[model samples]
Target: MELELVRLPNGVRIALDPMPGLATAALGVWQRVGARWEPAELNGVAHLFEHMAFKGAGARDARQFAEAIENAGANMNAATGYERTAYYARTVAEQAPFALDLIADILFEPHWAPDDLEKEKGVVAQERGEAFDAPDDRVFEQHQSALYKDQPLGRPILGTEAALKNVSVDTLINFRAMHMTPERVVVSIAGAFDRDAIIDTATRRFGGLKARPDPEREAARPQTGHASETRKLEQTHLVFSWPSPPAGSDQLYAARMLSEIFGGGMSSRLFQEVRETRGLVYAIDSATDTLEDDGRLSVYAGCSAQHAHEVAEVVRGQLELMAAKGPTEAELKRAKAVTRSSMLMGLEAPSARAEARVSQLFLRDKLTDFAELRARMDAVTCGQVQAIAAKALEGPACAAAIGPKAGHGALEAFGAK
Candidate 1:
């Protein structure tokens, strides 16, 4: 893939990942601020701001924003994560400029009317209630809370009901003013498009935006101690988290492979051993979350209340075995192929490319070429995977399980005989 990096005069960074023969284009604006960046009192403001962006901007009202993208024969949406919020639109190559303009308007010119803020507060409150009611979602939040406790990283992106109720137009507007500066944003375009023309458009549209001093953000590094908790539900949701590598670490690549081998797919050890062989779980997986300073390796599983202990044992056993004996050569080969193939398949869509470009630029300040990523995956070895697994899985770890009262005892057995 040919990648171009353009820095506008106003300090906004633009990354273009052009696919030569495609007719579709994906464009998005990515901001570096997210749930983690908010002050404790402003927990979910970043996410609420994301919702408000679609309410109206410039000449486009909410209805107009929807119609304009639909008329262009495209899909438009946005999401907020632990580290960033992204607004994206996908359309034909010819409509790329319009899509870009619409997104820019939404980001820079939200109305944030008082009535709209009141209405959205109710909507977000409902959304928050729904999340709390869902066992899968609620359990993960519990796990995260226990794992990172009292830190910004542990705070829910949706904030509390009281917090959401108190969020006024002034709060959101203040947040936008402080965090949505050119220095903290990246604009990305992917698929068939004229690179020079897109960059020119971006320069004209975004080049004059003012830069602001970035707000002081809390440092997320320095290991927090392990913690755990129990809750009431039908199935037990167990999570194990330990400190790992930050993004761009040499060991980070190996950490990715380790996560895949443990639980990335149906063929992975966790699935094969916990579900297929023992019928202990309906879902099981492991992942690595790499931030700017520190990272975590987490394993999650949902199983029958009666089987929670067995499931935890098997999951822990798999990691212990991998640490002691390393992954087999065949396991390493399959993991690499799975990782590479997943990357290739995901990039086939214009929106995927656009999102990928935005994420790379925001997180790493670089465009990740498919070929280079594949090469890196191809080069991981069993020794490296085992080394990372041992390092990440070592020492006491945190676990949170939400299930029937009967399952409370299972928490005590995690990483235990």
Candidate 2:
């Protein structure tokens, strides 16, 4: 695998990864700005802008845009996240240029039809409602608020109904001009594409934009407390979060190792103990959610209201045990195996590979070799993992729950009032 990189005179970065013998390709334009960069008044304008981009751009209406891609046998989509917004496409290698053109059109030549903003706002309202109605999703949203408190990071990416109502075409246009500059954008393509043509097209399309100062963003301020919502559901959804190393930290590999051993899989501690052994919960898992400036070690479980307290206690016990003594040698070996296999498996897919490239460029400002990643994971010792776990437990944990019990005893178990 070889990666070709180009930095245009205007500060736009283009990365091309050539995968020989593959028939398809995946490519995208990823910007370093997302919900966190949005002003409070425009909280969800980024997401709304993404949805509207497809409605019309260049000389095509929404129908024309859809037909263009379908006619070319290409797929196009976009996503907005906490720290980034991506416009991406996947298609046969032969259609890579057309796919790229479609993406470019949606991005550079957006045509916000007069009625589109209102309709999109209504659509997003439905989206926000659906998310609010799902107990599990609602729990995570509450957990996020607790984790970041009053910070932008705490706010839901799906802008509130009030914020969405405030959005207009001018709002979207202003937000784009502020954050979607050349300096914050990366154009990446992977798979069996004509590298020269792709790079040339990218340069011609993206190079004209003038460079500007990087967008301002608030540093993540992780708070530790409890957030809860009561609802009459069959089972309680509980989430526990602890502060952890941010992205690009040396301790990240160790932190991930700890998560894998703690609850990443069926053979892991939380699953085996909380579910298979004690049968306290039907589902329990742990994951490390890392962003550029902050992260959290989170554990989630679904169980009967009656067993919520017991489940929380068990989870706390397991976390403390992991932090105190680390994983057994067997557990460590298994974690390494799981992590290594997952990395390898992801590398086999063009879309996954493209996403990884974008993430690496954002985090490390360069593509990290696979061998280097594997080496780092292999070098994470039990002591390192233990240190990461113990350090996270030393701080206050954020807890969220939504259900019949409203996390009555669960939050108390984690010492979150």
Candidate 3:
């Protein structure tokens, strides 16, 4: 990977990954702000800001923004996450200028009209409804809320209807002014491209923006335990979350390795034991989330209400066994292969590569190339994996469940609410 990092005079960090021979490239404008950066009263503004950005910018209306990008043979989208919000596009390398211009316009010259704001609130209301329409998705929100309580991080990214109604045009404008500074953002591009040409285009487009101080984000310390929402559903959905290390910690990768071995695929321990052998669940998996200051190792399962407790028991047993005995050499090797293969396969896509590079710049303040990352992955001993499992699962576990009212008793017996 040919890589270059340039800090423009305006404080924007620009990273270029010029992959040779590929015809297309991906670029992203990543702001070092998201739900985590919002205050209590402003819970959903970051996500609301994302929706409004697409409504219009400078000389372009919403339709013009969409039409221009389509005309340029590209697609553009944005997402708001716990620690970062990003806007991205992937297209022929020659379309970099057009893509960057549209992105820059939205970020730097957004138009937050009153009509658009009210219309957007309704749009987000519908979006939030769709998200909650799925029991599993709704349960995860409750689970996440139970983990990181009384903070911006715990709230849903799409703020509640009450919060959305409270957001005004001035709020979005002020948010853009405060958090979306050049210094707190990164512009990254990857795939077949001329590094200097792209850099010049970025400078010309994003050069004049002034830098603002990055907000002081309150750290997220999870308040663990149980929370359950009673709902009428055929399959009970449950999530168990335990504390883990932060994004930049050395233990972060170990937690990931441990998580994958525990429940990553059909071959994983949870899948085989809980799903294949006993047939307790249709879907069961474990994953980890690493935020700027904290993280979670969680398991999710969708099971028949009558047997949800059995699924949790099996899940608990797998964690206990791994924490006590650690993964076997075979398990470790297979997990490494699975993780490494997944990484390599994802890097084949320009969009994935661009997002990874930009994320590294935004989060780590630097990027770890594949070889170095692989070396670290290879160096994680089985003992280290076991140790991480023990430490991560040692804390109080937070669980949230959505199912028939009758199954609440079963969940309580399993130490869930």
Which candidate tops TM-score? Answer: 2
Q: lDDT (0-100) at residue 293 of candidate 3?
A: 78
Model 1 worst lDDT window (10 residues)? 221-230
**Higher-scoring candidate on TM-score, 1 or 2:** 2
Worst 10 residues of 3 by lDDT: 408-417
Tens-digit per-residue lDDT, 301-329, candidate 3? 98888887777777877888999999999
Locate the minimum summed-lDDT window of 10 residues in model 2: 405-414
**C-alpha lDDT of candidate 1 relative to the true structure:** 0.79
Q: Could you give the candidate ranking by TM-score, starting with the highest?
A: 2, 3, 1
Q: Residue 93 lDDT in model 2?
A: 94
lDDT of 2 by residue, 1-417 (tens): 488678889888888888888999999999998888877777888888888978977889889989999998898999999999999999999899878888889888988975978988888889999999998889999999888887788888998877777888788778878887887899988898988788788888888887677877999988778988888899999999888899888889999999999999999999999999998888889999999988889999999888888888888888889888988889999999999999999888889889888888888888887899999999999899899889988876889888986446888886777
- The TM-score, computed over Cα atoms with residue i paired to residue i, of candidate 2 is 0.98
Provide the lDDT at 126 for model 1: 91
By lDDT, the candidates rank as 2, 3, 1
Per-residue lDDT value at 397 in model 1: 66
